[model samples]
Target: MPPPARRPVGTVTRGTTNPNRLRRVDRWIGYALGGLLRSAAGSPVVVDLGYGASPVTVLELADRLRGVREDVRVVGVEIDPERVERGRPLADPPWVDFARGGFEVPLPAGLGADARPLVVRAFNVLRQYDEVEVWPAWQRVVDRLAPGGSLVEGTCDELGRLAAWVDVRRGEDGLATPRTLTISLRLAGLETPSVVAERLPKALIHRNVPGERVHTVLGALDRAWERAAPLASFGARQRFVATARSLREDGWPVVDGPARWRLGELSLDWAAVAPS
Candidate 1:
């Protein structure tokens, strides 16, 4: 049988990433999966797939993930050979390297045939693709995971203040399943939870309509935020916490509590907000 068709490779993105532009998402990753990162025996590999023109985000991700696992190795993969060539000089530590590759995630052979990556963070990589193409793209990436691995695919603002992503896991059946949806906003500037509608992953971006589960979830979040306005007297953080708490009370299957809410993050089961 023939392999799946390779995705139509696209042009280089603007690749405009600042040092801290992805901090919010990185922090969430560290918090959400630190244990898995720390437990990998021999330097676990992590991929920053589609890291654009600048490799700064990849470097930053390495620095952050290292806090939890000192031996973590990060490979910044770019589809553009020129970008990879440009980033090579910046590879200081041997563990952090830049490679020219697409979603296939090519790595050095001796790293261990069993060395599948624990995490693949593909941020801002799918925003430009047709919404219908996302699932297959996600499947391609998830299929490359090591056992008990995760693929985090999402989009965030240039500065990372507003973002949303879906966590895909390689399930027992070898199929990737969306496990959770996470939204992080800058509470102070948040007018409504739906403001983040623009940052949803490609799979659900087009599903934000009247009867879709994502739309309903956003609507519920907006109403809960409005109902919690009384708590705004304390601060935007307080209001957000109250709002998340309310959603939990209303049976939205909120995943985290006040601690995570304080960071302007809300996570729910994928089933709760996935397109229906």
Candidate 2:
């Protein structure tokens, strides 16, 4: 029999980006995985996979994670050699670096195996691939994570106002499993919760059909959002908080509460929206 098809190693992305366009996701990463980053025996390594035309996001990620892990090492990986070379100048401060690599996440010698990365953030990367390719792509990346490490893959609008991602972790048994699915939106402009369906990670983007799990989750979110409309008289923030709270009360297993919801963020068990 033929061996499994080799996963694609690297491909150039559209290279679109803007500073702070990823703040919501970065904030969530800092909150959810900060402890693991801080607990690394030495400086922790983090990869900003497929960082686009500019290195601004990588710099920002380093700044954010540094608040929790002072010795965090952030490497911005780009498949485009020119982009990688262009970002090299900003790799000073010792704690940050830039390299030409793709989903395989090639790191320097010292940072491999026992010192493998603590986290990999691959936003807006897989959205360009066919829906069927997302699972193999996810598996390839997750397979390289260090034990207890995490892989965050998702997509956000160009301006970063709305986003959704899946968190996958390397289990003790050495298998990768989806842990949670999260959505962050700019509530003020949100018409319906379904607007975020456009930004679901590649894995679930095409799974938004009428009877799919994702569709049901969005339906629930829209209902909760509508039920919270009265609170909009106070502010969008209040309305979002109420909606998130309503989701939790309705058995969605919402992850954070008002503090996170006020930031236009909501996370639920992956089971809630996994393709079914």
Candidate 3:
């Protein structure tokens, strides 16, 4: 019946971001979580925690969700006050706005205590935190989610070409329920899908070792990419598509179909990629 305990704002991130750098994840959220937004009981609040220097990604998220559910709202939370100030000029009232906060995911005071967000899209935010610090941060965010809400956190390269993220939901017990690990790449010049290793979320960054589940996933994905070489003439897109299909055929528990694969994205159950 009382308010949740508040946590001090986290440290400022590197604050490096570029236009379109997070387009991959943004598009994924729109297509993947569209149904969740539509069925939301009340107003849906989506948070873009640690949206670096530009508010472009948060704005893009707002735009994407608005296209599906007009009532969707987006709040861009940054630890740097200066970043918040710089992004305020672009705020668009009740739809899209920015505030200074951190992993604590502070909502505007006006929303009242129960205004838990429906989605918290945190990219490149936890990269700086120690791997041991990830779960607690995840708990802090997921604990604030509305029922059926999500906490999507990950890392990506500068140009937005390669990305890897973990999509987590909260359980009735108010703990994380990790669902999937998604790796998206630009197939044009992609040498191998495993190149996404450099962009793994903090949770799996160090876990890409011989004995880790993430390592096993990446290794298998790379091999699958190689075996799909005969499909090259069809196009890199098809090659990646077949690889995703092959992964499922080989019993990797890949969670998506060719529709997402054609976009150079592949998703597997978190248990398949989480540190073992």
Best by lDDT: 3
The sequence of per-residue lDDT tens digits that candidate 1 reaches over residues 201-234 is 8888889999999999999999999999888889
Which candidate tops TM-score? 3
| lDDT for each candidate structure | 0.85, 0.87, 0.89
* Model 1 TM: 0.93
TM-score of each: 0.93, 0.93, 0.95
For TM-score, candidate 2 versus 3, the one ahead is: 3
Candidate 2: list runs displaced more than 4 Å: 1-8, 109-114
Query: lDDT value for candidate 2?
Result: 0.87
lDDT of 3 by residue, 151-199 (tens): 9999999999999999999876778878999999999978889889999
Question: Which candidate would rank higher by lDDT, 1 or 2?
Answer: 2
lDDT value, candidate 3, whole model: 0.89
Error of 1 at 272 (Å): 0.8
When sorted by lDDT, best at the front, the candidate numbers are 3, 2, 1
Question: Which ranking of candidates, highest TM-score first?
Answer: 3, 1, 2
Q: What clash count goes with each model?
A: 0, 0, 0
